[model samples]
Target: MRQYSIADLESRLAPSPRMPVLFVGHGNPMHAISDNAFTREWSRIGADLPEAQAIVVISAHWLTPGSTHITDAPRNRVIYDFGGFPDALSRVPYPSEGDPVVARAIRQQFLDYEAQLDAQWGLDHGTWSVLVHLAPEPTVPVLQISLDYAMPLPELHATFARLRALRDRGVLFIGSGNIVHALGRARWEPHAQAWDWAVEFDRVTGDALRERRVDQLLDPFRTWDTARIAVPTDDHYRPMVAAMSLLDPDEDLSFFNEQIDMGSIGMRSFMTA
Candidate 1:
């Protein structure tokens, strides 16, 4: 396959409003209500990104057993799925409106999966935390799609690829999850440095993303021993797969927030145009 630059990707999608896809490794829930470096970058990204007609977020926080669900409500409410966080986080609201039309369209497009329209399960920290900085006013229609926890990485990739049709339709997709999220092994201090294995896993993931070898990421636990420590669970790692599935062989990719947090969480994020 031939690699394409940003210009080539833009030229190929000529006359159509093609939107780039993003994968954000949202680390701490505190970033939602706090004004930090990550949040500031999210704001800058919001300003620099192309104006999207609608936004769809595939968050790691929303996981279903055997079926996928898409938010179809007219309006979205914040779902504080996490606990032990500050009270301020609970008070923060993102009330982004939802587009049933677009949500229904997504359901129809994902014919290979058991996709269903859902009225409940609002935006989780994986979404609103970033959106609170990305789109402060939150006027755009936003939708959240659930990940089928039982699906394999390959099937999840194909299921998410179905959304590629919406790229030219002015829909922006955001996959929110961490590449390395070993929460149990994290150092809780503020000045903690990343572990060696965590850094190595992140580097490997970055290499795969830059070279467009997304297949290399499907089973990191089997490929690298470090992955067992970096990705003990699939929840966070799966969102990266979902985001990668949206990219074609000829798109330009760029990284952001390339750092590990609390010695474990890899906050490396990327965008494919």
Candidate 2:
């Protein structure tokens, strides 16, 4: 990938046009309430993003084994999917409205997979945790599409690629998950040095993303040796793949929060340029 200066990247983007897709490495739930480097950056990014008609999030936290689902409620309730966190974290309410119309449109695009309109599950920490800082106002309608755990990586990527048309209709698509989320290998301490394998996997993944080599990332579990540790489960890494699938052939990508945290989790994030 060519190294594009900020000016070069900005010049390529259209003036106040379609929304850019975002792949956010939402590392810790605590970042939802804390005033940290990651949260501050999220806020800054949100401020810069153009207004959208609706927001669609593909979150790592929501997984359906056999099918895809999209939230279609009029309003969303925050789900505290993680325990042992502060009470304030659970109390943080996004109060974002749901777009049933947009949800139906998403389902129409995924009809081959028998996509369902879901009203049971609400926004999990993978969403509100980041949006609490990103779109703090919660005025725009928000919807979440679940990951089909049984689907192959390539198939999932192909399926998501079809949704790129939504961007033209003023939908802000966000794929929220960490690149290397090996919780079992994590050192739960501040300033913990990242593991060598974690760093290596992150570097290679970033290289693939920068070069727009989505095939390498689609099967990282077998393609990259370090993925055995860096991607113990596909849950976290799949969202990034879904995000990249939405990239336009002519679109460039810019990365931020390019660091590994807690010895194993990679906080590298990227967006369309």
Candidate 3:
């Protein structure tokens, strides 16, 4: 892949417009290519939203420390980062353009933050899975801001605060991750079962978010009762923390596809006004 500097790519794209915020519970990568209830909810959510100028997705799958990467290439590739999936899954493609101008603008928001321009980082399953359903045309200019896994709660919240300004510029911000993700517990059960730990954690996290308990929501791994089981790993849940931070306390929040998947995973998604 040809690489371009941050400055080189920023000159190619246009500025963004004001857009809404979304916290999607992007389950298994299989959902990306398959048509199911979760995919239907994603489609509905996209239909309900106003047109957006650009989209910035904070995916649970893309985690880095200190610096965030922005893609400046003309055509971004679909990254099949997962294994043990069917060949059909690997063939699914979402051909979205990269917006370097928006990427630079986002980098400017973080005063002390380092934003790198990379052509290598493509759309991971966390991003393409939901986006395939949300923006099927793939015409929208898209950029991904990496999540710094090493950063503490306070720093993460501060970073998201900078991103809140993008909402007014018509850049749809989406955090893709499940609220309750325990891969070991996922089964082929017909109805969603709320494991004792999963239920408690999801409920508490929901309450904390609704009540505007920023601190608790920021660091669920340590504060929540079922932190260990609910999260287990920071891969999926971390993006929600970033999305939740961008939310307005007074905005009306709604959950989509609210249910338990398998036995433990929480497939609940949220939209904030």
Ordered by lDDT, highest first, the candidates read: 1, 2, 3
Taken over the whole model, the C-alpha lDDT of each candidate is 0.87, 0.87, 0.79
Tell me, by lDDT, which candidate is best: 1
Q: Which whole-number lDDT from 0 to 100 does residue 254 have in model 2?
A: 91
| Model 3 poorest 10 in a row by lDDT | 9-18
Q: Which residue runs does candidate 3 get wrong by more than 4 Å? A: 1-18, 189-192
Model 2 stretches with alpha carbons more than 4 Å out: 1-16
- Winner on lDDT between 1 and 2 is 1
TM-score of each: 0.93, 0.93, 0.90
Worst 10-residue lDDT window, candidate 1: 6-15
Expressed as tens digits, the lDDT of each residue in 1-273 for candidate 2 is: 233354542332224467899999999899999997888999999999988878889999999998888998878988999999888888987888896666767776664767888988999999999998889996678999999999999999998988887787678899999999999999988899999999999999999999878778888977899999889888998899889888897899999999887898899999987
Overlapping backbone residue pairs in candidate 3 total 5
Residue by residue across 152-267, what tens digits does model 1's lDDT show?
99889989998898888778899999999999999998879999999999998899889987667887877788998899998999999999999988998999999999999999
Q: Write the per-residue lDDT of candidate 3 for residues 66-107, one digit (tens) a residue.
A: 666766655788889899989999999798888656766777
